[model samples]
Target: MKQLPLVYHKKILVLGLAKSGTAAAEILHELGAFVTVNDSKPFEQNENAQYLLSKGMTVICGSHPENLLDEGFSLIVKNPGIPYKNPVIAEAIKRGIPVWTEVELAYRISDAPMIGITGSNGKTTTTTLIFEMLEVGRKQPLIAGNIGTAASAVASKATEENTIVTELSSFQLMGTVELKPKVAVLMNLYEAHLDYHTDFKEYTDAKFNVTKKQDASDWFIYNGEQKNVTDYASKSKARKVPFYVSGKMKEGISADDLYVYWNGEKLFERSIIALRGKHNLENVLAATAAALIFDCSIENIKEVLSTFHGVKHRTQFVREWKNRKFYNDSKATNALATKSALEGFSEQVILIAGGVDRGHSFDELIPHLQNVKALIHYGETTKRLQEFGEKQSIPSVVSVNTLKEAIEEAVKISKEGDIVLLSPACASWDQYESFEIRGDEFIEQVLDLNE
Candidate 1:
């Protein structure tokens, strides 16, 4: 890890002690910073805060204290989930104290070259693909950021020979200042997380932070088909490399029915790609561009792309049984995600959907329901989604109390040449703790059918 002289002996506040915050606080303290860790959880109940206290750092718990900033901190390393509207963050901003997330700290200490990936969607899939490709190429790659692992933890262990493939969120990007990657990817941006950012422009601006500090020597791989992404790429100082799904781009990665191309040169056959959906095609194009720029061989890229089914819970292909295919898309926690998943299939889809009721209408999904042969609705949104499916005149519409029952119904109705998909159009919180758990249930039960 690089020595960060800027943090040495400086008084820094590490706010909201989750995994990111704990890692940041420990790293800062190790770097000779006077680190004060804070969290809303009470001292007795907060294990992270307790652990930090054991390490000889000052720990604040239970509340923000209202006067916490009055102690005079040099900087605040905030948790990405914490909004700027928080009193402590707002005060720090007003005082010009420079608030940042742990990703900034990761950038400062890492010896490895980073490849940052960000977008409204596809970040995880793209990040995983790049990491796998680099691995196949024998390039040492470490995955981190929003894809489960903490960036600061990964960055600390990364060597000069390693490449850190990070999945960045707009929240994490918002706190970054000088965190420029060697190859930065900005996939298609859409309207999302307005509640956290407060507006569309701010959300867009936050996503652009991935390429904000890049120089001419760096590479910016973006979506050429997205006008917003292309317009933002124009502002980047990095060498722009855009990927197009429609196969119309003059340069960079574009594809036709036959092959995937890089700068109009054939790299691999399109049929080799195992992952479904045009959305995934965009991800593949962007990931390929980044991997190629990092010097990965075409052979290695093709090897990974051909075999990689998908990231789990996000349109992951489970298995084929009785000539029926199954996909676990439990991460489709909204209508848009389900729509994208539905579009990937040409075969009759026995779609199992419904989850936590956010009270939003599923009317937006009307146009995409044409291919759905059966709709097994479950969870809190069952009635709403059942109504939607019945209104759409889907051949078979069934409502169930649980996901297990829904899967059973799908199995009964599914026939040869059918695709049974679990693309719930709402969040999983109503029945499961997270989408991962919900997805795991689906995979286990679906696999049981083969037995």
Candidate 2:
């Protein structure tokens, strides 16, 4: 491997000085580009800006004004969180300065071919699955994107032979028009991030962008289970390869409990292990599709996936307290996910639920709550779900302001074989740092009982 000369020359404006944004700023600065770090957070609040200023780079805090756009700049590297809704970005577009996401900047820097994976759900599971599959097949891949590491961060350390298995969010893909991956997996598109996009169509369009730049030489693998994804993918110009868990894939892969059959041929399958439900099955299939496209041995993929227990936050089984089993699905941040998590618990469940609602209608999960023994509510949307529970006499309890209180109340009412589940179908911003933090705290509280 050779250290290539930095290609960026002109001044670059890096916006939204968050983790990904600041990383982009430093990377661009390292490339010898005159970097101007911009963010909406005030100077006192933005530790990144102060840190950059200490490092001798020009920093702009509080807002991205029109004057900054008017300033001669070669490129605008916008953070994933900064959407089209931002007035400053709107002004930038009006000024005709090219606006790019941190991910696009990441792709531009990397010489390695990529494995771009995006969907409404199952992204983290599938992303790690692909990375593991490639690893088992002897490819040292850089697993990155919204799974935590910025794409730019991944690119900073990438090599030619090393592949990138990216778990890209719609926000990351919104500005990506030319990121061509060798194998692109559009896992499954559904009603998500309606709070961010103008409509479902806009959101779906953003997820679909992963395949928009792919050529005929590249392959587009997707779940045929999602009608919207299947329909739009059929109309897409990319070389389509659709996979499914329920039925056969005309050009891609199909799955049974034993093996993932490709075009009616035996590709790969593993012995059934302790994977919980249907959602996980779907995740394995999506990963297998990408692995097959990348030339991974079918047997190696199945062997790894079979051994892979589950991700940290997605339906992670904590421990049994007093013969009562607890399932932590703090990653269930939408209505669809909550519905899926509740599918396995056929008996009465003491559900510890609610958080800041991510524009989800409770109606989608209402039918699935038939067996819920008690509904313990907390966070911003607690009352909304509690009121719904009252209409059906589901024995709802409201906690004063935190998830801990909700769990304490649910535990009191819970019986043996009665699942006490923390599948908050909303974001944790109102209560904790993120869903992962919320999940960790939930596990901590459960474990604290022993102490």
Candidate 3:
């Protein structure tokens, strides 16, 4: 196990006892730091804090004490979900105390080389595929960050012989200052998360932070087709590796109707891979560029791509019902993602969409809805989408009260050779806690039909 450097006996405050917070506290404690953990939940209710308390660390629960900042703490590690508007965090910043996400701390302590992936969409799918590709060569890569496992937890067990494949988000990257991955991938960029960020520029800059600390020796894999992505790549110090959809690039990966080419060399045929859509193909190209640069064999990469279905909740094909194919794309929490999901199917679709209103215009999705046989919308954005669907002359448009109702309506109207898709164009927070819960519910409902 590797101990974090420059942390011995330093007073550290870990705010919010989430998974990342718990891991950060443990790592700090292991490094001989005087760690104090604080959470909004009551002490008895906070299971993570209870375990940390049992480990002899100080625990404060139910409230965040503003005066904790004056206790001569050298640093504060904050959970990324906690907004900077939190009084304690703002106070800490005012005091000039360093505030970091657990990712930054993980980078500081990790002995392993890292491959960081970030973008608007395709992060989980690309990250998972890259980890599988690296594992093909017995590389023992640890997957972390937005993909589920906390990077701080992974870093504790990482060694120089291993590699960490991380799926970073704009939320995670915004707090990072010196996190330089050996291979950084910026998949396509889109206007997203304006609800959390100040505006589009802040969101774009946050995603680009994945490359901020890289040098000339590092590789930056990006979408050559996206001008926003290419614009960001030009400013990065890493060796630029571009991936394209229509034509070949001079220095990276590209795909045509048949094969995926890496630096103009044939890598894998498009037909063999299991994942669908041009978006997923872009994800494969990005991963291929990263894997090839890491010395992974083309055969190993091809093996994974051939059998890899896809990650859950992102255009995942569920069971067919009455010859109508069902897809769970609950992770399509933005307009661009839903647009991508719609492009995969050739037949007219019975689309289930609409969720929390992020104030984004669904105008981009209108063109993609041209082949829709029916539009079933639910949650906060239902009325807006239902109205838009009707205006766009989609054959059928219905507004439902819940996700289950939306699915039931779609199932009722879906015909043979039509696609039933759950590709919500907004966040799930208005109805469900997260996209995973929403997707699980859709799967459970669809599975019940089999009975």
Candidate 4:
């Protein structure tokens, strides 16, 4: 399916006119697919759908009309964020029309082989690291997928010389049926997105789909530290390559605190990795494993590992204010991620957390709060988290109504040598539209302190 201008003249329905959906619609139309775009937002309000309407393409805005599904469409390209429980999607499945995310369509048309990375956490860091390593090796890697850009956007211009290094989410991978990469990395898995997935097993299976369609020639790089990750990788037909933080691996990547050993030879000092947090070491190992499978030079891996600090919103260092260091980890939308953020800081921290409750307990976050000097809670989970912090004997646990208030309170309580960390352990739906927006607000507030 590497044929140029694929999906030509085939009737297709594009659901959800967000980034991925809009990009998919434009490219599908460009590829000559008889495209009809749909989104839940009204045409007047949805700039994306409105833009598509002006492109001489058929668009149904305001709602996903059921009648549009029966327009002799051969395929349905859906937005990854749109849940499987969506009525139109469920109906499309019932009618035996194939459903795919833009990633699948992009995969079918991409001229370059792909290196797909997916896990519960650290995917962005690992994917960015691999992209840098590939770039150093002159692989002409195009980064896409769940990170930001749609895969098809990169695929539309790719050639056989390029390699697409994509960050796949369970949301993206679950819809993929034929997407296969030359190198697939499963960093690790944790219970996440239970709000979207039906259950833990379903989420696990969705992430494991990265290697489901690979053949023996392809490589499956997995976290040797996680039995679950290894267990799922075992089901893949691809050759298994395990990366670990403990013990030596004769064929894959392994690391201790000090050094990273790749295939029994010392690769680089783990300390050279600019990214903090022990969990990030696992990401380093995963990226190193994938780079090695892609045949990247060892020097390139070392160089990238030494220089790449981290991705934005994942332990991103904002700015030091009044001798106190501040970190923005607004991407920490779950207990595990917040725990990882706290693990990165050795200094006593003024922690700001809370948001929409995902019906999970804050018990998983208690152990990581030993270094927290103060806790500022806000949004829906404020009371519960403040209570939890009080019960845990935290020195200061204050509840606020908004994130801005939480940030201001954190600034007042923090002192020199203390770190201000915004590691919200819940979703951002209560106040902001996305984690990126929440993180931006945190940064904006922190930047405002200079005045």
Candidate 5:
């Protein structure tokens, strides 16, 4: 790992304590920084805070003391989930103290180059695909950032021969200043995450940060079909490589009904891809571009694409029971994601949807619900989604109190050759702690039906 001289002997505030925060705090302390770790969870209940305290770092828990900024800290390394609107962060900003998420620190310390992937959806699948392709091709790739592992932790051990395939989120990118990946992939853009960001523009601006620091020597692979993405690519200094799912693109990656092409040359047959959905096609193309840029062989890319089912919780196939197939798409946290999941199936779908109402309309989902035979709604948007189902003339529409009940109702209504899918069109925060937990529950419940 490279030396981070900027943080050496400096007073640094590590705000919030999750995977990213804990990693950053520990790294900062090891680098000889005077680190203070703060988290909103009470000290007794927060094991992470306790662990850091045991390392001789000062730890504060339960609340953000209004006067905490008076400690003369030179930098604040915050959790990506913690908004800048937090009073402590606002004060730090006002005081001209630099604030950053751990990704910036990861970039500074790593000996390896990074291939950063970010978009509204499909980040996990795309990041996993890149990692798998590189692995099969015998390229040393380390997966990190928003794909479960902490980028800083991965970077500390990364060598110059390794390639860090990082799944970046808008929240993580918003805190980055000079993080330039060797190959930056912008999958696509859509309206999302208005709760954390001020507006759609703010969200898009954050996503653009992935390629903002790249030079002409680096590569910027983006979705050419989305005008917003293309417009963003126009401003990037990197060599532009666009991927298309609709029309053909001569200079980059594009796919037709028969084959997947790379810069006008047929690289692989489309039949070899196991992943479903047009959105996934977009993801596959982007991953292919990144893999090719890294010198991964076309044969290796095809091998990975043919066997890789998908990332968990993002339209993953569960089990088949009584001639009925089940899919867990609890990662469909927005209308667009649900729409994409629906489009993947030609079979009649018994869609189980509804969760935390982010005040976004479900109107965009109506057109795609043509094949939905049954709709089971739950959580905050239960009534709204039920109404949506009825308006779309679905044969069966039921409102349930919970996901378990929704699954029960879907099984009863679903017939042979039908899909029982849990692609909630909203965030899981209103019911489950996270989409992963919600999806796990769905999988467990589905497996229980066997007994």
Candidate 6:
């Protein structure tokens, strides 16, 4: 179905009432929709709610937006924080009212071609790298979606020739049906966000939705080694392209001698990839695959390989003391991700692991304990991880409360060649505003040894 430009007179239900919620309500209300905002947080303390109310939006605090399903709205603009099976969403679907994320709503109005990147491990790194590749031309791309800014903010000003590189989260994927990407890449998927999703299968279904709506006209790139992505593409009709870091793909991108391939074609070969870790290699492969699909010059991808600095949080090299490195991958907020983070090291490593438990199993990361010199446990996630470590007879030290204490314990136990790795296999919400905040704090504590 061709998407219509949203008309304003329709009644709209904007749910979640967070950062995205406020942006959605303001845009809709200005466009003439009778907007009602709903959030779990009390409207009195929410700054956005107070501001939106002052601007004449009908704010409904601490209530479900599902109550308004009978009001006959044209569409529901859902916040990505709300799960797809979220009670309000199911009710809206039952009522036959179209539901969209700010992304879907933005896509309908955007005249530009969007390039979307998704996966459990490397969305931000790939999205940021894509943006850097585009800067090869004089064109400055709109880097939005699940990254820098909401899609609505970009859509408000997009033109046909403008290019957008969007990072898509699974929650954002759930609300979008036909939001096709010119090039969509899924790096790899692991069990993440099970708490929000109720189960692993449901969470994966949402992540896969990023490519579910694609046709022959859209390009889909996925990890060749990821059995889940490669295996599922055989069962689906979407146009499939595989990328690999260890083994080479027959027709798509692969790494051999620090070079990348395209469909039966060698596009760019480089020895200048400076990012540490195999996961980052996979990330670069995804970025290069999409760039090649877009007909980005081999020279451009080559240039980006060296010039494109990595993102702030993930596996960032914070400091080196006595030639021993300190790596902060605070974004490793799930068991699978932390496992990937640890595998980057071959030598004895002191790992600061654990955070708020998110209903994922600790057994998944147990294999990585072999490389761990010592485990400096922190946050509420420690008890479970310690239990698993003890059962395996892996060496560990227990410390809770703050990252400072965790790092201090790790440093005390570190040998000259041992790496200090802060790769928590859990969320940072228990201690910091975000993974970014947590990473920055880890860097601060690491740098303080010079004091």
| TM-score between model 5 and native | 0.94
Report lDDT (Cα) of residue 433, candidate 5: 97
Query: Alpha carbon lDDT of residue 428, candidate 5?
Result: 93
lDDT of 3: 0.89
How many times do residue backbones clash in model 5? 0
**Per-model CA lDDT versus the true structure:** 0.93, 0.81, 0.89, 0.87, 0.93, 0.78
Candidate 5 vs 6: which has more TM-score = 5
Work out candidate 2's RMSD over C-alphas: 3.2
Candidate 5: tens digits of C-alpha lDDT, residues 1-451: 9988889999999999899999999999999999999999999999999999999999999999999999999999999999989999999999999999999999989999999999988899999999999999999999999999999999999999999999999999999999999999998888777899999999999999999999999999998889999999999999999998875668899998888988888887899998888999999999999999999988999999999888999989888999999999999988888889998899999999989998878887878877998889999998788777888898888999999999999888988999999999899999899999999999999999953
lDDT of 6 by residue, 59-134 (tens): 8886775456766777789888887677878887887888878888677767788888888888999998888887
Q: Which residue pairs clash in candidate 3?
A: none
Cα miss at 70, model 1 (Å)? 1.7
Local accuracy of candidate 3 as per-residue lDDT tens digits, 80-161: 8887778998898889988899999999889999999999888999999999999996788899998889999998899999
- Over 1-451, each residue of candidate 1 has an lDDT whose tens digit, in order, gives 8889988999999999889999999999999999999899999999999999999999999999889998889999999999999999998999999999999999989999999999999999999999999999989999999998889999999999999999999999999999999999998889999889989999999999999999999999999888998899999999999898887456999988778988888888899999999899999999999889989998898899889999999999999999999999999998889888988899999999988999977777788878889999999998888788888999899999999999999989988999999999899999999999999999999999954
> What are the per-model C-alpha RMSD values against the true structure?
1.2, 3.2, 2.2, 2.6, 2.1, 3.4
User: Model 3 misses residue 451 by how many Å?
Assistant: 8.5
Instruction: Compose the digit string of candidate 4's lDDT tens values, residues 282-310.
Output: 88888888888778988888899888877
What C-alpha lDDT, on a 0 to 100 scale, does residue 226 get in candidate 6?
Answer: 77
TM-score of 1: 0.98
lDDT of 2 by residue, 28-100 (tens): 8888788888888899988999999887778988877767876688778888888787887888788787888
Ranking by TM-score: 1, 5, 3, 4, 2, 6
Model 2 TM-score relative to the real fold: 0.87
Task: Name the runs in model 2 displaced over 4 angstroms.
Answer: 1-7, 54-56, 235-237, 248-250, 257-259, 266-273, 320-324, 345-348, 356-360, 370-373, 379-387, 390-402, 405-418, 449-451
Query: What are the clashing pairs of model 2?
Result: none
